[model samples]
Target: MTDAYYDFSPLYRSAVGFDRMARLLEAAQRNGQENGWPPYNIESTGESTYQIEVAVAGFKADELSIEARENQLTVAGRKAANDAGDSTERTFLHRGLAERDFERRFQLADYVVVKGADLANGLLTIDLARELPEALKPRQIEINQPKPTLEGKSAKSNKAA
Candidate 1:
């Protein structure tokens, strides 16, 4: 855990192309003290593919929403209110499972795109894949072979006897 008020001025002064990383670190530090609800896991399914599973026990498929915009992925869940009358309500002796609504966000790297999402049992899984553009992909440069020059060949050619 880091102090929420940590100064990043030194990092900014000595670094280049690291502004996004600094922002991410600052955001994490600021949200460090927050409670970890609806725990999640991020896993690499392939060389360039990933999956994020979040435990949303009581939330239904219809009650959850997934959105991807720019470089951010947001998942939110809300329990719908029951339409039944309050007269038929029953109290629980031990309510350990939390049914509170929650919203979770994940920052994605460049070229990473959300493939799909599925909710089954009590887990919500979001799939992602990285697709690099042709211009950005690594390429091999061909080295040209130099043409052989004719030895002793000048502006005047030697006459043969």
Candidate 2:
């Protein structure tokens, strides 16, 4: 994190409603090391909806945890300790799979909420949606239309003159 890859303070001076983005960038810069370990893909599933799929090859459903709070989503995985003498336990010949503990943080946009998550076939899929409030959604505004008058004030004045 010493390389200072992202310096967003300068843009903060003139920027409005972008602090969340800046924080996201800074968090990514700080957690650069843990960003690449668990490969993940973010795909748009619908209008204002998204799905994040993380490659958790050797993790079980109970070994993983997902939490969403304050517009930030965190997914973590931890391996269970091996039993003293398990009948089905076997030694790995080459040990290539990285089943190590890891944590991944995702910064969500405004009003984005985690709907649900599922772990299947070594892949974790999390669903999110941008549930914009009613006030923020587009709506029709009634425009007042003046009623037609038989004679306006200016016209009456001209007739009197």
Candidate 3:
């Protein structure tokens, strides 16, 4: 399939890190379009802040796990059947939403961190902030005063002689 945003031709001769990001985007696009599983949305909070919200109903806080490793953000959920003491039979006539389990990953920029997560009304919201490295940020360079000209130096030496 033709890439929607990435051009492999230019990336072939480029650096390795960009190639990896391209590959990651490709994988994400494929997985994102493949199974319309729990829908999600990504929005930019500011210049370096962002948020990703997913519909995760019937999932508790303990049933979810979020991890950030090697510039990858992974969100996973596993709902285990409760089988202790309490016994109740419940049936749903029209069951549509998924409450099973799922794993979703997002490739993050350097120094980007997962700030926090909040679950409300069946939506799982994950916040992220991109904190650029010191070296990567722009800095002002102080200019020094110019040294005495060659002509001035020569005149001073002649006066001394």
Poorest lDDT segment (10 consecutive residues) of candidate 2: 147-156
Winner on lDDT between 2 and 3 is: 2
Separately for all candidates shown, the number of backbone clashes (residues 3 or more apart, or on different chains) is 0, 0, 0
Question: Which stretches in model 2 have alpha-carbon errors above 4 Å?
Answer: 1-22, 85-89, 149-161
TM-score list, all predictions: 0.74, 0.74, 0.72
lDDT of 1 by residue, 87-149 (tens): 677689999889999888788999999999999999999999999999999999999997775
Worst 10 residues of 3 by lDDT: 1-10
Error of 2 at 60 (Å): 1.2
* Tens-place lDDT digits, model 2, residues 3-64: 54757897677778887678777777767755487999999999999999999999999999
Question: Which candidate model has the greater TM-score, 1 or 3?
Answer: 1
- Global lDDT scores for all candidate models: 0.86, 0.87, 0.82
Give a tens-digit lDDT track for model 3, residues 36-77: 567789999899899999888888888988899878887888
RMSD versus native structure for model 2: 5.7
Q: Supply candidate 2's per-residue lDDT for 27.
A: 79
